[model samples]
Target chain A: MYERTIDDTVTTFGVSGKLWRDSMIMYDRATESLWSHITGECFRGAHEGAKLAVVPSTQTTWAEWRTHHPGSRILFKPGGKGEGSHYRRYFDDPARFGIHGRGIDDDRLAGKDLVLGVRFGDDRVAYPIAAFGDASVRNDSIAGVPVVLIYMKESEAVHVYERTADEKTVHFEPVIAENGLLMRDRETGSLWNPARGEGIEGPRAGNRLERIPATKIFWFAWQTFYPRSRIGGID
Target chain B: MTGTAVLFTLLLQASAPFERSQEVLMGDTLYSVLPLDAIPAIDEPQFVPVAVADTFLAPTEMIIGVSIDGDDRAYSAWQLDEHEIVNDVVGGVPIAVTW
Candidate 1:
């Protein structure tokens, strides 16, 4: 098993170009209006050094989820259509877990843990880990959509077991090079994008394009927002 | 209606002038719901002071404390020494104060 403590706490902020708006009122720094389209069930805090609450997705209606995770911020794909519904797909909801109709492929990942990191937009990225009882992720396009599978092994390395994003299929082997996570192709030895295509290099294939350090990613996002303020009142 | 307006205008003139002060404090309490009349538009990116007091604010392990008095009032005290609870990389409106 990959025995490592992953810092699951993440703080993601909107990119510079992305607009931040509150639907409750007109945009005014003084009034501190509520957000118009922010959704997803996650805990958010408002202190300069406040530990933000990371609300895990609970399988319930969006309204119920918001009651528990009021301050959670939702992340959208870069250049994505500003859709408000269907946030439950990405956000976790205990009630809706198995209801999505996607069952876990336990047989494929018989004895490994899969750790994956995703980079979205400029300063928004997250690393969510899920264990498969005994399943394997195949390197194939699912319904013509690209996806990557991470599998853990008892003795072998935990790796990007499969890559099937952007309509291309590629297999990757995880190697311990430079004491960091690296993905190399099993067949052509070409670098691969964990999501769609082969990356630039095998040893550190997705380092440049993706695979950013989780710590640096957090630091960059936290720095973008002004420290949480306690504005006494709005005039 | 005219009498009510005259009374309100008289009350406003009788009160002291409202002078605005800005400070950047480290805290996690949600102070956004304060009445709008108390706080006006603050200049974005202002480097206000962050302070904590013993009775008003207390610093515990990695977390600062702001006390809510019996009257349901919020107050704080700043630590004389400047300590960073959160890194300065996040640069939006930093306005958290804990007592």
Candidate 2:
């Protein structure tokens, strides 16, 4: 997700049907500039060198999201047939599609493994979904910035946050409560909804964790762009 | 140089290196590359506001939820699979949802 504006002009974008490094390229109607969907940067045309601001988002099941946000709205195509996922076959057996030609040289993880990738400056870290399994929270640092990564099985959503609040560093542990899995900060014992990045209970109630924008994507696609990214859960 | 010329020069300086031929630009080998406009990007997709309960999608279906300011909205992956893009506004923020 990206804010579609270039030089104060609010623009609308569409798929250019172009691919760069196995990612979709977008083009703006205002300038016809081509943008990399992954990086949100324009690579061609009059608006080349422009970049769209990244917005933090989550990819999860409808049931989980609806349960958490009862009043939230959903996207749908009226009178449209539910053909199911277009990439279901590709996701089930990624190797069959061979989207990445000749395969990736790095064998750190399988090409099709899903990962949550976070970047700070030039440093990047990837959390493999397979490693987290169900609900888990990891308090770690990237490029010296203390961060927390939370994974929820029910929603299959990963959220990243800066764990500092009120100038105090907070540590988190995964706890199962009436509301399901939540991150409980050790210092203040505050229960946080990682997806919403909000402190729901304890001394730090009402405080919101600073979200770190991240992407949940395939290892092959991420590695193709961020080859030097560190894999979390690896020594 | 005029202000517009200066801005253009600066933008060009910051832009990524461009290939002389559009073919070379679209000839990436890492993935199965498609011809330019082969998939056809959706330029003007429509979005309507509706209550969550009113939605007809399955419970397991995926959606990309975006919250800007205090407004929150979701873009169905099923719809995106067909259109590939949607330009919409949330809380006065113009956003592009690309699948």
- Number of the top-ranking candidate, with lDDT as the measure: 2
Residues A1-235, model 2: lDDT tens digits: 7788778889887656454433556678887788877657677799777777866677777677666666565554555545444333343354632322335656698876878888765678888887875547888888788888887765455678889989888988889878568889999788888777898888888999888767667676566557888998622
Cα lDDT of all candidates, in order? 0.24, 0.65
lDDT tens per residue, model 1, A142-219: 224333443332211122222442344545555544533335666557554332234666453443322221111111
Where does model 2 exceed 4 Å of error? Answer: A83-112, A116-216, A219-233, B1-32, B35-55
Residue A157 displacement in candidate 2 (angstroms): 13
Which pairs of residues have clashing backbones in candidate 2? none
lDDT of prediction 1: 0.24
lDDT of 2 by residue, B1-99 (tens): 011111122222333432221254533322213334454444544455545334455677667787777776776664565566677777788887766
In lDDT terms, how accurate is model 2? Answer: 0.65
- Candidate 1 - CAPRI tier? incorrect
State fnat for each of the candidate structures.
0.00, 0.48
lDDT of model 2 at position B76: 64
Cα lDDT for residue B74, candidate 2:
76
Model 1 fnat value: 0.00
Candidate 1 chain A weakest ten by summed lDDT: A17-26
